[model samples]
Target chain A: MRRIMTGPNVVLWLFMIVALLTGCRGGAPLTSWPGLTVAEGIVYVAAGAKVYALEADTGNQKWEFPGEEKKGPFYATPGVEEGLVFVGSNDNNLYALDAVTGNQRWSFATQKPIIAGPAVAGDTVYVASADSKVYALEAATGVGRWEFTTGNWIWATPLVADDKVYVGSMDHKMYCLDAESGQERWEFEAGGGIAATPTLAGDLLYFGAYDGKVYALDAASGQKKWEFQSGGWVWSQPLVVGDTVYVGSMDKMVYALDATSGQKKWEFATEGAVLAGPAFADDLLYVASEDKQLYAVDAATGQKRWWFTAQTSIFAPPALADGVVYTCSQDGRVYALNAGNGNQRWVFPRTEQ
Target chain B: MSQVWNLLLQGMVNSLLFLYDVLAHNFALSIAVFTVLVRLLTLPFTLPAQRSAKAQQELQPEIEKIRKKYAKDKEKQTQETMKLYKEKGINPAMGCLPMFLQLPIMFAFYQSIVKALANTPLQMVSLGKFASPSLSQLVPLGSHFLWLDLGYPDPLYILPILVVATTWIQQKVATPPSTDSQAASMTQSMQITMPLMFGFITMSLASGLAVYFVISNLVGIAIQYFITGGGGLLPQRGKKGK
Candidate 1:
């Protein structure tokens, strides 16, 4: 029996040893791609389970909401309006906090996680959730006004324009609903899922879709004005300035299209996929790429002005205010750069130590 | 090391996505098909290991006689064992090679599945690195498979139980019979402990991985049964009376 057991015993021991070694390689905590929003001299950023209010110029912590464990990570950027900061969490709750004090005013719970930031319009807040519903809540209270269910999960933030709420869903359709009654205005079917929030310019609503197309539709009637095919999925919200609409694509290129005709004007190529939407300042478009670099491009010519290499990939869109472009990277460092020349103003979590 | 592993895992991810695309984008069917494809791909290495194990089992009686003959002369016993191994054209370590080769593939599969079923924004962004543009179109793949959320643990504990049962059966079939009573008892303990440990682990991890484990074990058992001609670690019922 000893002789017979020797081989199998050795195999078992080897299995155990391998199992132990592999088991020790546990997964790291999930890092959330929480975007930054600057409002009224304060920068609101969500990291881990806390929402931090930092002094926009100095990067010093003001206060954090909850002041303790919140039990969920925040991924949606905070929307600031009327002295209140609204942010969504993976905890399936949308928190409304005092903008200056970081004190929770109210929280509205949904059936599933809220990954999209809330849009505050008048006295109502419109938010989309992964539960396949777009909820309208009373901004002053945590009471639900009404909810509009979609065919699939809603990842794009709701766009409110002229008493109408425009939103897209993974169900491959974009729905425009009346802001007051949650009544559907019209639904526009796209070739693929709509993950990017729609941008409004004049009467046209512009957005990118997973179908590798940038579409321009009539905001009121949901009629397709024109569409420009891209080489890859367009996952970033399009930014419109003047007559140009600049959008980034997963194909590692940013294209400038005429807002009216959807005609491609010019394109700037990046080293990696452009997942973050472009932010416009001083006739320059600042965009972050998955290649660990942020670039400043001329809005008119699509010419690269300057670029700043980050420590890691930049997945969140850069927030620009007061000539400083603030961007966070996957490596856990937040950088503030000069918007004109792309020089580093300061980096949070100071690397000196 | 992790970079190399990530690159290898990317290839696995692409393969899985290919299967998924072929299977009408059904995530559950893709996993089942991918598991079968992996088993078939490793069959060449496994065949040799199985033959070596069978040879080792067949030579056990002769090996026992040699051990008794050179009971006190350890050096002679070693020399004789080497001679017997040479004559039989059997490499003693051959049985281990297949298991060793499977380690990296198993890890790659685990990483690929976890990343593919990413539920958070950061995870989705990270998954973009490994997924092709075509595959990215299928983001947020439907994880529900017959009441199981592939991204989360199985609350009903059905998959975990199946994992344990299938793993126990596979281990029993693969473990060669032993002659020493203490060794046999040790083997028995292992057969029970290993499955229990795996079941416990499976209960805490994503149910998709547990599905892989159960299917892989079932396939392993089927292969072992064919290779060993129905003889396994379990004793034959009618011969037990003798």
Candidate 2:
């Protein structure tokens, strides 16, 4: 018995050593960043490998999809449309679930992980994947209609506007495709990768790129009208409100630019990288930074009104609705704050005694 | 605990980014440079470990004699072995320092590569905190290098095979031979199994990590060759020919 146990013990020791060496390779819990979506009094959040629906008023759990046997983490915000919740999972599946009941309606599998939320049209849902393909799927049946392959991964959310689909790719190109057929209309190449969704205001399109520049393009022709360069990569989606475009950069600065000429109107500096897009409500802009502070600044003047400190880094954009703002921190806690004063109203997954 | 880990991770990321910048933004070249740099930095500990291993190998015959003399009494065998080791100025514990030091660095490099080649918005956001102002502009670093996407697994299986081959060669060259037949066989089995296991792991992880492993193993083999005067695992022309 002693002789038999010796060999096995050596093997077990080796196994433990190997395990220690490779243990860090395991998947980390997805950062509860910006995967919060609020619609019709329900706040939908994706965290801990599941999609959760919480009562917006009370921070109570309403329902959770995929209660058990979760395939992967959710990094994209859930797109709620017509009683259906659409979300992309790192499992490489785009799932459409019933919003109220938490039942899986349908799921379409992609070749690679889906990191961007689906853009819902009337009957079609468009999503981009790390497989370097943009897929248009049937909203109800989960059947793929068409897929357009790019030169590299597509990490930006698809924007469906003016009967077309616009998406940015890590290939440093912005593609305008026919929404119905996935046919390419035009492509505009940027100096660096585009990882942020492009925002459309009137006839112009505004977006930021890893090239450290914010671009204003003519929506119809994919022509660059003007570009404003920043000190760092612009990963935050540009928010346009009445001739001013507010965008944040990893340089720890937020710039408000003129919508037409790309002229910098004003810029606000933070202590750390600004990862979240500015949330505007009641003429106040809410911006979260990795500095662990959520700053409420004057949208027009770029002057800070107030700032609230969180327990950890805030990477997700604050969602503003009904005089309340919702944001998530890297510490896995969600905060509901008064939009006007930046005071915490309540926290999700309430602490235990 | 997590805060310390985060800081370590950030340090590794910053080191890699700095190398990337210095190497003209070539990701693969940067990894090669970083591997060489790490090997050079750990030379002090590795050299002592190699010397100790050589001393242990040289004393293998004496150790075997002691084992056979006290085979019936296990406690006496252990005491005699310890006495022999101490008399010969051999510290078995010193031989493990190099490996122990490398374990954390290997894990940290894996994490740094994963974060540097982030493919999603959430990953990019998480990476934002560790990125310096200049390096942040390189977010979503280009993964293309020859036939591999650094961020994804190697599709051609080339990296996994190379990693296994290099790791096997390095282990064979670095591990000293034992006098006991059973111990020799066990070491031989581990020499084969460890590489295969790591090959399987490399097949699933990002190809950049596999690249790092290949380079690191190659450097280890070269270091072993220099320390052992090209004696380990090398073809002995005179003895073998006779």
Candidate 3:
């Protein structure tokens, strides 16, 4: 029927059209792309040309910031601290967005692409560029604090803990730098490229290398605590919670190891590869796989608790908030599911542009 | 198995293979070949879409009159519209028949590309990890295009530019004339905005999608020429923009 377009109706219609376009039969943009980041009380998702700030607890959209239509196809998850969100773009720049207003604060230009998301600590924001440079910028003004050089590209997110910043390099080295001065404290050579970030717990640091080992190093001295080997390369970041460290190997197995000793705890196998980091919430560890499964495993047992199979493989990590797990599939579907049961809550369809 | 179901399944498989073998391996060739194949596969609906689009365009004046007459009467307007469509042997759905029919094919295409090129494993065809001599024995799954990986956007941004240019050409050629002023305005805006938006996306995320878009647009142009003797269903002007 040809309905009369009232003000509310017009708004509804616009929403419906957007809903239709978003719910089109092709690929859902929000869930298909990897721009989901959770910080403070907001969950920021970069979909198409907009960045949406959603209430983390309620799963409701709070605000949507209209971004440049021709400049940024933003995939970097926003890093938030002190009322500001820092993110990178394919435009070869890092943007500091107001955490509340979603307004652009200031942007820093980079030499090449900034694929990895920005990481913030205290007054400085650390960003890894595809151009093989790790930059530390002043969080307030987007001014450069320091830029550290690496041999090859730096796509891994830089993690800062205990006054040290850890980053992996395509140059086959894991460089530990002093967070304040940006001086290389130590660099460990790997058999292959180190493309994943290191995780810190207590005095121990956990990270993966192309050498196929999940290495445990002392955060203070960079001394090797232990190294646990896997069959294939380790691309996914390692997660350390309590006494266990969880990581996925290109060998198609998710391995759980002792965080302090790097001894194998238990392993769970899947059909495909896992490139995204695992999220630990409650007693469950949630991981997205190229096998199209979001597996929730017992954090202590390393056994699969429940698995939700998506129509397409998920290369991006699944974000968990409230009681729901959010993830995207190559099938172009963004799904919200009950974290405990692995039952589908809602499926947003994909639309073709 | 049901006849329609079989067709859908086979169509999905065919699209997957063609996208990998033809599109990624040899893009231009794949686009041309697949466009024709797709057109021919949906050949049954082409005539109907053409007939419907032409009918819809022709009925615009009459439809506008009816809309004006019953503009306030939502139910009456709908009934009148349906009645008119029924009386004229015009299927309003005809224009979308080919596209609707191609849904399975499109899904399959997305699946295959994301799996094969995006480096996801769920839809992986398992092309048996081949050791490439150049890049340290890595199992290259045919996702690489020149120096940039199709799965991720290139830092240099050469592919995204090509994507925008080709997309603009395709949009300029394929967009149909709109009788409704609002629709026309929206269409115009979309034609300009979509390419720019997608160009940014390609620049940001995956260049492979841009490759797919470029090939798809070129193929679409070819399909239009082959089937409708011009630029698909859209009227061919002297130059694209006008």
Candidate 4:
């Protein structure tokens, strides 16, 4: 049956209302998480606009904390602990939400967008903001503990170790700040901005720079321990598993190096850039590539174990937990696969609203 | 270098850099200012676009008549359509000329941001030649306005909201009335879906581009109002000095 109103008039009216409504409610949803972190039995994921926590075993939604005022999309990974979830938003506010209820706990306002994930140590939560500052906040109260201003934007997650916090900034400086005071302990200059998350293992700290060098520095002194060269920029965080440091580079190579000496163990070449950090579980290293393929490589030999093809780019690191591996594709799909066989278990289409 | 290509590339670069710099400092305020600047700069083209749109609107009756006259004949229909357009001194494509012209500038803007804000070493290799080490140390290419980074996805989503609001207002003010049933219906569908679609897109993509679009649309409306009449929606002035 034809409706009472047909043709363009009806369409036009409908469109007008939709436009008006959408215009009035023009809020973006944070749909993608820069990284995923799991603690206790809860899994934390950051998408484009919000942070979500699910039961690690059930994939059941436990809670979701919406961002603060116009802080629409948050690519930063959420750091979770003790019923508190810490994440940053484009709204330039660092938010602390009740991990179980998804309620606002308290928020620390920043001068710029907080794209980098927050890292926690003791009572302090360290976050880097686009305003070229690394902030340390009281983990419980969301109170500003201290802030250290850098020469440029700080996009790297702050790595807290010993009594110091390490972060790389767009200012091309690798900074070691006094965790208690937020004062610069020392800063070593790189050729370009440090966008990679710093990795800590024993006495040395490792990070990739946009300047094409992977520099290892003494954790205490900030002195250059060793520098490894890649064909392109290394944006992925160095993952330390046992004695090996695993990282992927924009140069399209995933390198495995000895954690102590920074010596090359093995390298695997891919067709596309590797922006996602490598995930290690058991003896297999799982990595996602922009080439639309997820590869499972043998940790010891760097030999390909299994390869799964996706329709779009896979820049998000796969979450390996229990017996399942979770990964997201650019086509807006989240896939859960069997960790042992790399077989598909379930797929969740992205909700575009 | 073709004039269109050059305008598209250079204008886009200029627009992107200018917008980035402005929004980097203050998203809401910079977008407001950028809108004004863009509309003002293209104010001269507004009349031509308006006249062309008006001319087509006026010739709609005649075009409809032609369509009816040749309703059944596909070849003659095409020929008559051209004849009507040519005789009336109207270019059907003129209605989209400004938008088309704006394409290059849009692309250049996108390229500039991706380049300027990129943190990868590969992006840096290219940076050494284009990026002044002195400025590189100072400018992170990430814009800080209030709390959001114009370079990254907005956390609070304030910019996306503003973007949708401004775009919807612009769309409402600019949507032309249609006399044809099919065209009218299509227009209505487009009007409704386009803004919402754009709003969602802005929500998902980089906040920087959304800021540019919002500012550009608002600016376009203001320029049209001043150059034409108080409504800023239609061209009140016709070719006088021409």
Q: Which candidate leads in DockQ? A: 1
lDDT score of residue B57 within candidate 2: 65
What value does the TM-score of chain B take for model 4?
A: 0.69
TM-score of chain B taken alone, candidate 1: 0.91
After superposition, candidate 3 runs with Cα above 4 Å error = A1-33, A47-50, A57-59, A330-334, A344-353, B1-242
Tens digits of per-residue lDDT for model 3, B75-94: 99989988999999886766
Return the TM-score for candidate 1, rounded to 2 decimals.
0.91
Report, to 2 decimal places, the DockQ of model 2.
0.24
Q: lDDT per residue, candidate 2, B37-108, as tens digits?
A: 877886875777778766776777888899899999999998999899999878777766665665565556
Candidate 4, which segments miss by more than 4 Å at Cα?
A1-34, A67-71, A258-263, A330-333, A348-353, B1-139, B142-242
Q: Please provide, for model 4 over B156-221, each residue's C-alpha lDDT reduced to its tens digit, 9 standing for 90 to 100.
A: 878677866765656545544555777667656755666676676667555666666667666655
TM-score winner between candidates 3 and 4: 4
What's the best-to-worst order under DockQ? Answer: 1, 2, 4, 3
Per-residue error for B100 in candidate 3, Å, reads 35
> How do the residues A31-123 of candidate 2 rate in per-residue lDDT, one tens digit apiece?
444468899999988764778888898899889878767565777778988898999888889999999998999998888878787899998
The predictions' CA RMSDs to the true structure, in order, are 3.3, 5.5, 13.3, 9.6
lDDT of 2: 0.79
DockQ, all candidates in order: 0.37, 0.24, 0.05, 0.10
Q: What share of the true interface contacts does each candidate keep?
A: 0.16, 0.15, 0.00, 0.01
lDDT tens digits by residue: candidate 1, A96-169: 99988988999988887888889999989999998999999989886998899998878889999899999999
User: Among the candidates, what TM-score does chain A have in each?
Assistant: 0.91, 0.91, 0.83, 0.85
**Model 2 / residue A54 / CA error / Å:** 2.8
Model 3, residue B183: C-alpha shift (Å): 50
**Which lDDT tens digits does candidate 3 get at residues A106-163?**
9999987676778889899999986789999999999898999998667678998878
